[model samples]
Target: MKSMKSVVPHLSFCVFLLCGNCLAAPPSPEALDACMRGWADQNLFSGTVLAAQDGQVLLHNAYGMADYNAPIANTCDTRFRIGSLTKGFTALAVLQLEEQGRLRTSDRLATVMPDYPHADTITLDMLLNHRSGIVDHTTLPDFQTVRRTSPCALARTIETFQSLPLDFTPGTQFKYSNSNYILLGHIIESVTRKPYADVIQRQILEPLGMHGTGFEYYRRPIPNMALDHTLENGSIRRAQDRVMQNAHASGALYSTAHDLYLWDRAFRTGRLVKEKMRQKILSCDAEYRYGWATTEMFDRKILAHSGETEGFCSTIIRFVDDDACLIVLSNLEGCSMGRIIQSLSALLFDRPYQLPKKAPTGPQASADYGAYVGRYQIKPGFFIDVTTQDGQLYRQATGQSRLQLHPESKDTFFVTEADARITFEYGGEGQVARLVLHQGNRDFPGDRL
Candidate 1:
């Protein structure tokens, strides 16, 4: 067994066949915990979840190991890096500064940073709501390369894309961009003449007594902090450390699931800012507010956000109308976070929720593997190369680690790396012609290329 040779011991799973059917569901909330534990026992899940209603704590628990090396188990208080969820903190700080009459939302970026391109036309309002027309630095190939190697500096990072043209007219359309929040972080610094971290600490974290949350520093050790993990080539490994400056104000924050609940509670009680300002932040005029995406779930107005970085993923959903909140934080990336959040919300409302089941596996035919082994275009410029080695199949995305695919049926396959499934569509002649990758609630199709 590979377990003998690898640092991470091979996982052992009980075959709870549930009568030979992979899915045995309509699980109660308690059963949901068992289902989640089942995934963890299979070496599939690692994280914490907190669900509450009307200021009442209903469910709070953690699963899997925080540091697989130290073998530290995750707890409700274990801190995890929360990718873009930091945007909410960033946006709140800006709005708080506005409430203090320190800055106005209509202020032009050019007024504060003269060198920024189109600063005259882009307003603070635009940056807060992701209508600034700035290109997402996170998606740029060069930025991605540089970030992994070194700590990104604010000035140097902003200058990298200052001269570039806008993706659209300012405020004319909505486009999510990391550059927007990075710039907002800088603006916070400029207005207060303090480090963004210090300002955030003073404004939000300190005020709420959220001692468990703060900025992430790679070299600085955090007690009870879960080591981030990433899936690479069908194996789980420590997530690569990047310069904290790379994520900076945009995504560098870390917090526990419970602390995030305090965050949500702050809004509920109007403790974060004045009611009028808070209302502005919660407005759904444009499908998004300062740091939240506005949407309807179970016919209730919900403000939510999800975060994803190299080794971490997180989500926070606030049912504004129902006075309820659901938060999930993870050290592992792409662990089916979206579906899990949705299912938890449903269970809370007495809606039907099917428990997660193991993706079934079956024997492959003589030519079964060969027909699906080929390169397919995931997007115009992205491709997934499917290859087999030692009679086992694996898939690699562009610039990403490969994962093995387990067959549930003849044409369908799934992977535990992220609850992702793939299926090849057959043509009239029977050879595969197109592929579909399904995870959570989204699907991406790829034509054989």
Candidate 2:
């Protein structure tokens, strides 16, 4: 044989050629570290983050405080209520049951829960893919008050939305409904003859060694659990608490970034389910599949999901083909998670990314302040009221607390609490006509009423 060094070099070149764009170099940990540190210093993020490639961790760190009142710092092991990220676990449990021949995806809802209205027309697959047309229970009129006051069992939760008419014929359209997953949770319990939480603990968490993950309940003392916070009126405050059981299988799980990393790795290594079943979980026949959303970013396929509750928001993104993943678990609600995700992903792929910038302070007083004060209708029953107090501008959405708007330019202002900007547009007479809200890479124009 030729020299071993020459052979190694040839093998490496062939591997690169075979893998094509999938073989690009992984992002530097230092770069990711610097980006996160900048965000934390700007108070843009709190909680933990983990990034990994090819089963090896590149950056695993925590930032800000776990409990702002106690001034306790967060660690890598800090657990966070992951909101809708719990759906992924619920989905996986369903798939595992299928693998065990407990139930088939094609089974009709009537076959499982015969009493549900229109059950005969809906299939389990429809629920899995969010094509079931079931109304989202969380959108019901009493959801906020009821969820905060009491814990509703799955059956009682089902009663909240069961009688509501379907939004569309099952399997003809896709509509994301927490009710679908809640029903799946009930099915899991019914078929296994065990509580949904127990099934998850025994089948998934224990086997994957994810000891830090579990369902959350009200007032449960979980060690190192981060207290949820929300940005309000340009200040950080504790978020309003909700009864976790109300979230049910839809969004009640809490976990750490490290444990979530293990969750991602299990999917990659086929440790959770066989390869065929894994593909089924990740299938993109619809925009939503088995609790994850399938999409592409930077020309690479991505399986991602995000969760938001009263005081917490979380995200997990997996570049399945490249074996790379990013997990962000945050306690502060209403923060710009999209901006953070996009920036981190850009750094990961060597694309252009920007660091957080300090909010600008414009003049102490401006004559235009009075002109900008008015209510603009964004849509039906939704309005944004702009007002000035003590020479500072503020914007308040319908039913939300007023947030101070920092002047970025003569007619444009930014909110320090979120990655959002507002621009005032004037009509021919120099009168304010419309305003535009720029956030999360989208623009919403609100006409002056």
Candidate 3:
């Protein structure tokens, strides 16, 4: 999975706010529309959004173009490849199967896939909560080439990473790995003697009337589907295609905001799974449950998840106790779903919020840019490259497209295309020695490499 650079920081806070008794009324439709319009006008957002409270729709709208090449406008019904948001559905499928007595969360992986490496040590519950030690297949070195090639058979896909060393001992650590869900998908198929897509279609989509949703596959014509796009060097362009089958249960589903709202409603009404299973899905015992992450925002409990794939980004935030939810589905990759979701949450709760504004354009030239032109290590395998191209400053994270940085101040630079800011720090020797990334209300410090 591509690191949701801006969203991961917020997941770390997980603040449990107690505001049930003091919950604010939902924002007016006009206010919410205006807020989204501001983001669309600033090119910070492009897609569909839906917000609701206490089972009442507060706002549902679409913004910007669905297909820039075709000049097609986005509509509330336009479907987007929802990326990792599909994991929630996959989790739901697993829980539903358990409810049917076909499986149990406590079952060992060996019970389903006996030959899988370390299968005896991992449990379904561990995979459900992302405590499985399986390395994320998407992070493997050959994943890029694999995704571009013809879809591999499920067994082949499993074989590619099945023997790789575990990232950690099973159930001993929490690491988000798409391989867990892929394995779950395989197990589901094994138990039911059916394909994963067929099981999901029969079990969830049909029951909830989510007619606009289905598995995304190569060469399939999905009506009203929005073509994914990405921000490249400050310009929006079409993203390369991936064989969605490779994403499998991890991220192969496509749906509309309305369809996703139906999904949220299903959880609220306990339509698919019983109350006990629902609680298991939302339990905060593990920071992540099933496929959703449990976090606290605005003094209310939140069941949320963010999704990112080639050129699509999506997020769903559920204020569960309040029966309130927010869904954003975008075709443009690198759009700051975290910032947009935070602002919308603030507006929904009647808290102070600011609509996006044009990013400040500082002096066109800065001689100091030379000092910041080096790679900085954020983590063992992640680094940010600050470089100059034709006098413009740019920043690129490992394995990500470069984005131009506009000077916000002498030591601070901001990315106009994303809700990200960077500040260069000087060492005792007066040399630029480190950089800090500011996004999603958190700061990530990186040392010069």
- Candidate with the greatest TM-score versus the true structure: 2
**CA-RMSD of model 2:** 9.7
Task: Give the range where candidate 3 is weakest over 10 consecutive residues by summed lDDT.
Answer: 3-12
Return the TM-score for candidate 2, rounded to 2 decimals: 0.91
Question: Which pairs clash in model 1?
Answer: none
- Could you tell me the TM-score of candidate 1? 0.87
Q: Per-residue CA lDDT of candidate 3, range 1-449, in tens?
A: 35231224434432223344434335999888887887888777789999999888889999988998889999999999888888899999999999999999999999998888898999999988889888877777777666545687777778878999998999999888888888888999999999999999999999999999999877879999998788765577888777776778888899999999999998998999999988876665567888888878777988888888777899999997778899999988877677678768887888765554466546577676899999999999999999997788899999878888887778998876666789999999999999999875678999998
Q: Give, for candidate 2, the lowest lDDT window spanning 10 residues.
A: 1-10
lDDT of 3: 0.83
TM-score per candidate: 0.87, 0.91, 0.89
Which candidate number would show the highest lDDT if scored against the true structure? 3
Model 2: per-residue lDDT, tens digit, 1-449?
A: 00000000111111111123323233888878887887788777898989887788888999988988989998998999887888889889989998999998889999889999999999999998888999988777777667555777778889999999999999999777888988999999999999888999999899988989998876778888999898776568898877776677887788999889888888888898898888786665457788788777778888888887777888899987888899988888766676677667777876665555566645557766889999999999999999999877899999777888878887998886665789999999989999999865567899998
Choose 1 or 3, whichever is better by lDDT: 3
| Clash number by candidate, in order | 0, 0, 1
Candidate 3 collision pairs = 17-299
- lDDT string for model 1 (1-449, tens) is 00001100111111111233334344245755765676566566689988888788777889988987888899988998887888889999999999999999999988788877798999999998889899877666766566655776888878777788899999999888888888999999999999999999999999999999998776888778888786554356787666554677788889998899999999888998999988896665566688888776667778888887666778888988888898888887646665566567766675554445454345533445878889999888899898887777778888767887778777888776554679989878878898898854467899887
For each candidate, the alpha-carbon lDDT, in order, equals 0.76, 0.80, 0.83
Residue 62, model 1: Cα distance from true site in angstroms? 1.2
Model 1 spans with C-alpha error above 4 angstroms: 1-32, 232-234, 359-367, 397-400, 418-420, 428-430, 436-446
**Candidate 2: segments with Cα more than 4 A from true spot:** 1-26, 361-367, 399-401, 440-443
Against the true structure, what is every candidate's RMSD? 6.5, 9.7, 4.0
